[model samples]
Target chain A: MTNIITICRKELKSYFSSPIAYLLMAMFAFLFGFFFWNAVGYFVSMSFQAQMSGRTIPMDVNEMIIRPLLMNVSVIGLFLIPLIAMRLFAEEKRSGTIELLLTSPIHDMEIIVGKWLAATILYACLLGISALNILFLFAYGQPDWKPLLIGYLGLILQAGGLLAIGAFISTTTKNQIIAGAVTFGACLMLWVLEWVAGYETATWATVLSYMSVVRHFEPFSKGVIDTRDLVYFASVIFLGLFLTARSLESLRWRS
Target chain B: MIKVEGLTKRYDRTVAVNNISFEVEKGQIVGFLGPNGAGKTTTMRILTCFLPPSEGTASVAGFDVLQSPMDVKRHIGYLPENPPVYPEMEVEEYLTFVGRLKGIPKADLALRVREASEKCAVAEVSKKLISKLSKGYRQRVGLAQAIIHNPDVLILDEPTAGLDPKQIHETRDLIRSLAGAHTIILSTHILPEVEQTCDHVVIISKGRMVAKDSVQNLTSRLRGQEAVAVEVTGGDNAAIQQRLEQVAGVSRVVARDTRDGRHSYEVESLPGCNVRGDVARAVVESGWNLHELRAVALSLEDVFLELTGAGQAAEGEKQ
Candidate 1:
């Protein structure tokens, strides 16, 4: 456990010390901020029109503004997660430091987990920036903090699932550009799987849609914590990390 | 101690290390000498647990590399051909991370990093970013990380590869100082380095062990068929050569034209014969002013070329 933390600490330090981390953070914050502003503006226009028409429809701030914003954060994560995870293993291999890690006494699983944890933390920091944008909604309007917390929870779970897959893909190559492009392709495919449910309701189509990470995140985005969704995200995270460990083991043989 | 038996590493169609075996006693510095692509790096990688041998076994400090790699890793410090360093990290931070990876206790981590930096002479640049440092400083930083935990064995591959001559001398000295406390296996193709630093040398050619012996013994073993060079002046060249060949145990004599009017002859004697005294006496009795006469012992360079050249010739014929 200490070995894992030691690796995690060093990995995190490297991320922040490079220009990549800050560049990622700024891009995520700017994009998420744009989505937040649009959601708030749409919500205000709807409330003003409803009031002028003398309608008594009650609009919940959490439902009207925060939910769509959380979903937007998830979409933005599809682009951002690849950038964060691409360097985890690819940089190590390119720089020849993989030799140091492989020949160290630490287990392969520890190294994988440490690197994944560091990438996840950076993703969380990105999410935290968007969360600050949501804080303004709480100060003025009467928004329920509980559902906002659940929406952010959904964003994190979704990010965790995608980042793990990106981490696994990063281990397959030494070129960070290739790693990033392939991971982006994979995350896009996962996001587009839900379109299969719209076209056909066949058993195969349903299975494909069920595998889409977006489906599992729906309940949490609506302020409902379902154990089934938790299990799905947990399974995805486990499968991704398991594959990463196997990749690292194969690297020992092929090196 | 280190032991390898019939170790082989094959990458697809090419065999990098083929059926090589050797041993290193405790507290001995063994030089793994071979040309580029001759499997020196492959052998070191196997012992360091970076890769497993495709066949046979290797053990370091009583732990089999394939069976108990973590144990073997715990006992060995390895520096690959290129120094593995994080460009963004300061030297002290890099050393600290490697120390922790080597499982040094938290309390002793700072002290160990300091000691390692001082040993490798990178203490003054401890705060500088690694990418900003010069190549020699970066190489020393790599060495500092390897020795941060002070393992029982050190496996250094081309540790002095890209350094200047003074840095190479200092690195060799540092490696020599580490002897008697650590069993080190340093690999290089430079002949004089092995002669100057290593007590024992294991020469490999085409992934096969060609020779393994103490440095002195390897040279002396090839000294039996050595040549003697004689320089004489103020005599007819043909008469001088004729008289030199008449010495006891002299088998063949070849004379070369000299620019300064001195007659130079390379005399080959029968195996195991010491004909320097006889050649000197014969030249003196002939009234030729003998300027220089000495039996030329085979240098390590000659022995290395002869052994590897034999392997190349065999390979050529097979192909």
Candidate 2:
């Protein structure tokens, strides 16, 4: 446990000490704000049109503005998650500090979990920007607090799954650029896999569609909780981290 | 403190270190002498638990490197050819991180870092960024990292590879001071460095053990014969050379350089012979000037070359 914290602390320090963390946070904040502005503009203009049409209908602030806005935030995360995890193991290997870590008296799991935890925290910090924008809604109007919290929860879980995958990819190479580009490609594939279900209803198609991370995330955006979605995210996290541990073990032989 | 037996590491079809075995006793500083790509670094990696041997076993501090690597790692410290330092980190911060990772207690972390930095001569640059420091300083910082935990064994690969003469001297002093508290195995191609620092020497060539013995013993073991050189002037060079070769128990005499009034000759005597007195008496009695006469013992450089066989032909020509 102490080894985990030690590695985690050092990983976090390296992240913040370089320009990578600040640059990632700033870029994420700008893009998320732009998406939030577009979502709110469309919602406000539609509300005004309804007022002029003499139709007494209600609009859900959560569904109209926050859901799509959070969805856009998850999209932005797909791009930035690669950046968060690319340097975790890749940079260490390039600089030869992997020798130090491997020779130290720490278990391989401790190092992997420590690095994954640090990446998850950085992803959460990026998600915090969307929460700041959500706080603006709470200040002006009545948005149901439970659904917003659940929406944020779903976003974090999705980030955890993708970031774990990125961490695993980072271990396979010593070049951060290759690690980042490959992780982005993998995450994008996971997002578009739900399209398989649109045209076919076969068992393989259904299974592949259910494997889509985006499919699992859709229920969370609708402010609905499901056991299957939780299980999906948990399994992805476990598998990604398990593969990372295996890659680290195989390194001794390959090198 | 360390033992390796029948260790072999093969990468694909290339065998890196092949069937080599040696042991290091406690409280001794052994030097690993080898040419480039001689598998010295590969051997050290196996001992440090960074790589596993393909065919045999290695143990450090009573733990097998393959079966109980964590226990071996806890007791061993290593410095590879390149110093493994993070450029973005401060020296003190890096040492503290290594200390914590090596399982140092929270209460003792600070003291261990301080002791390590001072011992390695990196105390003054503790707060400086590593990338800004020069290569020599970076090497010293790497040394500091290895000694931070005060492990039972230290495996250093080319520890003084990039240092200036003064830093090399200080590092040698520090390494000597570290003996008895820590058993050290440092590899270097510098022969004189080994002669100066190592109590025992292990020579490897092309992944095989060529020679392993004490520095004094290895040098004396060359040819098992005593050598003497004599300088005589104001005499016929050929006649003096032939006369010296006739001395009792003298095997051969090779003429060396000659100046205006002095000529040097290298004379080799048979095993268990003392012909220095006989050679000196012959030169004086022949009415020629006897300038200098002394026995010449082989240096570590000659022993290393002759043992490794990398430059054996050239060494033979020189002799």
Candidate 3:
């Protein structure tokens, strides 16, 4: 446990020391805040509201403005997570530090878990900053804490799954650019699989659509946490992380 | 102590190290010498447990590399050809990370880091980022990391590869000081380094062991009878050569003359023969003015060339 935590702390320090983390965070925060303010103005302009009681606003109005903004933030996170996780092993291998780490006393599982947890933490920070929309809406209208919590859980789980996929892609090659591309390609395929499933007419296609990250996220966004949705997200995260571990194991022999 | 028997490593169809066997006693500083692409790095990697041999077995400090690799790794400190460094990290942070990775106890970690920094002469650069360090400083940091845990065995591949002459001398002195405490296997192409530092030498060529012996012994084995060149000013070249050849125990004599009118003869004799005095006496008796007489000593380069030739001849015979 100490080994894993040591590796995790070092990894986190590396992220902060690098410029990419700061650039990604600044871009994510600015874009999401700008889109949310624009969304608020658009939704209010479309409403036919006269000067009502100063203290009252429709509950659905805040949801209408905040949901699209937060959902867009989630979409942005899906792309940015790959950028952060791409260097986890790819850069290490390119620099030959993988040999140093693998020959050390630390277990392979500890190294894998440590790097994955670090990437997940960075993704959480990005998602956490975007969650400011919930607080922004609460300032003007009564907001449901239950739905917000559920949605945040879903975001974290989905980000964990995406980060594992990125980690797996990183182990496949030593080039960070190729790793980033492959990670983006993998995530983009899964994300678009649901849209592709929409065109099929069979029950299996509907099941495949249910496997999409979006389908599990819908229940959470509605403040309804179903056991089935929880199981689906958990399974994806587990399989992704398990594959990542296997990739690292194969990497020792490949090099 | 370390032992390797019938260890072989193959990449695809090309063998890198083939059935080579060697052992090192507890405090022997062994110099691993080979030409480029002679599998020194591969063997060191296998010893460090960074690589597993395709066939055969190896053990370090009584732990089998294939069975108890973690224990083997715990006992060995390895410095690869290129120092593995995270350039963004400061030297002190990198050393601390290495100490922890090597499983040094938390209480002793800081002290060990300091001791290793001082030992490798990297203390002054501890707070500087790795990217900002000079090549010599980076090499010192690499050595510091390798020894921070005070492992029983130290493996350094090309430790002085890119250093200036002064740094090379300092590193050699540091390595000499490390002797008798840690068994070190340092791979290098510099013959003089082995002559100056190592107690035993292992020479490899084309991924095969060519020779293993002490430096003095290796040179002694190749040392032939000493030859003296003598130039006589006023004697018939043939008669002088004939007289020198007739001297007891003188095996052969070849005489050559310059266009400017001086004759030089090379006299080769058997071991325990000092024919120089005999040649000078003969030249003076023959009423010839002996201009110059000098004896030549065999150098390590001659020994190296002889071994490389032997290795090549053996390779040719196998083909």
Candidate 4:
């Protein structure tokens, strides 16, 4: 356990030491801020229209502004998670530092989990940026914090699954660009996998939609946590990290 | 402290190390000498638990590498060919990180890092980023990382590869200082390095063992007889050669070119015999003018070329 934390701390420090952490954070906050403004502008205009029509009903701020804004944060994650996990293994292999970790008195599982935890924490930091944007909404309106916190929980699980996949892809190659591009391609595919359900109602189509990472988060976006979705994300995370361990095992044999 | 039996490694169809076996005794520095691509790095990697051998078995400090690699790793420190350092990390930071990874106790981590830096002569640059330092400093940082945990065994693959002459000397001295407390196996194609620092020599050629012995024994073992060079000035050249040949324990005398009436003779002595004393007495009793006399031994370079160059030919015909 100490080994894992040691590697984890080094991994996080390395991220901050380079410009990747700052660059990604800047890009994420910029894009999320744009999406936040759009979401709030649409909510204000809709309420004005209802008021002009003399309706007595007050609009729900949680549904109209925060929910979609947080959902858009997941869309930003599709672009950022790849960047977060690309260097986890690829940089080590490219720079030959993998030898240090491999020859040390640490297990392969510990190294894998340590790097995965670091990337997950970086992703959570990105979510925290979107959270700060949500805090602004709290200053002017009374939106229930419970639903926002639940949505953030779903975002964390969803990022965990995707980031794990990205980490696994990193072990297959030493080129960080190739790792990042392949991971981005993978994250984009998982996001669109459920789109097939719109055209076909077959059993395979339902399975495809069920496999879509975005579809499982639909309930969390509405402040409802389903056990089935939790299981799906957890299973994805397990499968991704398991495959990463297998890849690193083969790497030792071949290299 | 380390043993291997028929250890072999194959990447696809190419054999990197083939059926090579050798042993390293405790507190001794064994030089792993080979030509380029001669499986020296592969053998070291297997010993350090970086790669598993495709065949046979290797054990370090009584732990089989495959059966109990964690134990082997805990007891070994490795400096690979490339030095394996993160470019963005400060020298002190990198050493501390490696120390922690090697599981040095939290209390001793700082002192160990400082000790390693001082030993490797990188203390002056400890606060500098590794990428900002020169090649020599980077190599030393890699070395410091290896010894930070102070493992029982140290496996170094060309530890002085990128260093200047003075740094190489310092690194050799540092390695020598670590001898009694640490068993070290260092690989290099540099022959004099072995002559200067190593206690034993393990030579491999074309992925096969060529020779393994102490430096002194290996040189004499290759040449069945040791030669002593003598320059004599008083007697007839042929007569002096004959007189030297008649000395006790003398095998043969080959006379070199006479310069300024001084006859130079190479006196060969039979194996395990020191004819220096008897040769001097024979020359002195004869009242010959002895200008210079010294025992001449073959350098390790000649032995390496003779073994590896010949081994390649023998292996070529076998294939």
Candidate 2 lDDT over residue span A127-182, tens digit each: 88678888888898788988777888898899889988998999999999999999
Enumerate the candidates' DockQ scores in order.
0.73, 0.69, 0.54, 0.64
What's the fnat for candidate 1, on a 0 to 1 scale? 0.87
Task: Write down the lDDT of every candidate, Cα atoms only.
Answer: 0.90, 0.90, 0.83, 0.91
User: In angstroms, how far off is B234's CA in candidate 3?
Assistant: 14
Q: Per-residue lDDT tens digits of candidate 1, residues A110-159?
A: 99989988988888888888868877987889899887788878888888
lDDT of 1 by residue, B17-93 (tens): 99998999999999999989899999999999998899999999999998899999999999988899999999999
User: Using TM-score as the measure, what is the rank order of every candidate, best first?
Assistant: 1, 2, 4, 3
TM-score of each: 0.90, 0.89, 0.86, 0.87
Q: Which 10 consecutive residues of model 4 chain A have the lowest summed lDDT? A: A124-133
Q: List the residue pairs that clash in candidate 2.
A: none
- Model 3 residue B109 CA deviation (Å) reads 1.4
Task: Show where candidate 3 strays beyond 4 Å.
Answer: A48-58, A131-134, A203-211, B224-300, B310-319
Please give the lDDT score for candidate 1.
Answer: 0.90
Each candidate: RMSD: 3.7, 3.8, 4.6, 5.8
Query: What is the C-alpha interface RMSD of model 3?
Result: 1.3
Chain A TM per candidate, in order of listing: 0.98, 0.98, 0.90, 0.98
Tens-place lDDT per residue, model 2, B1-319, is 8898999999999888999889999989999999989999999999988888899999999999989999999998889888999999999999999999899999999999999999988999999999999988899899899989999999889999989998899889988999999999999999989999999999998889898899888877765587888888999889999899889999999898888868899999998888988888888898998988988985877777777775767747877
Best by TM-score: 1
Candidate 1 vs candidate 4, TM-score winner: 1
Lowest lDDT 10-residue stretch of candidate 1 chain B: B310-319
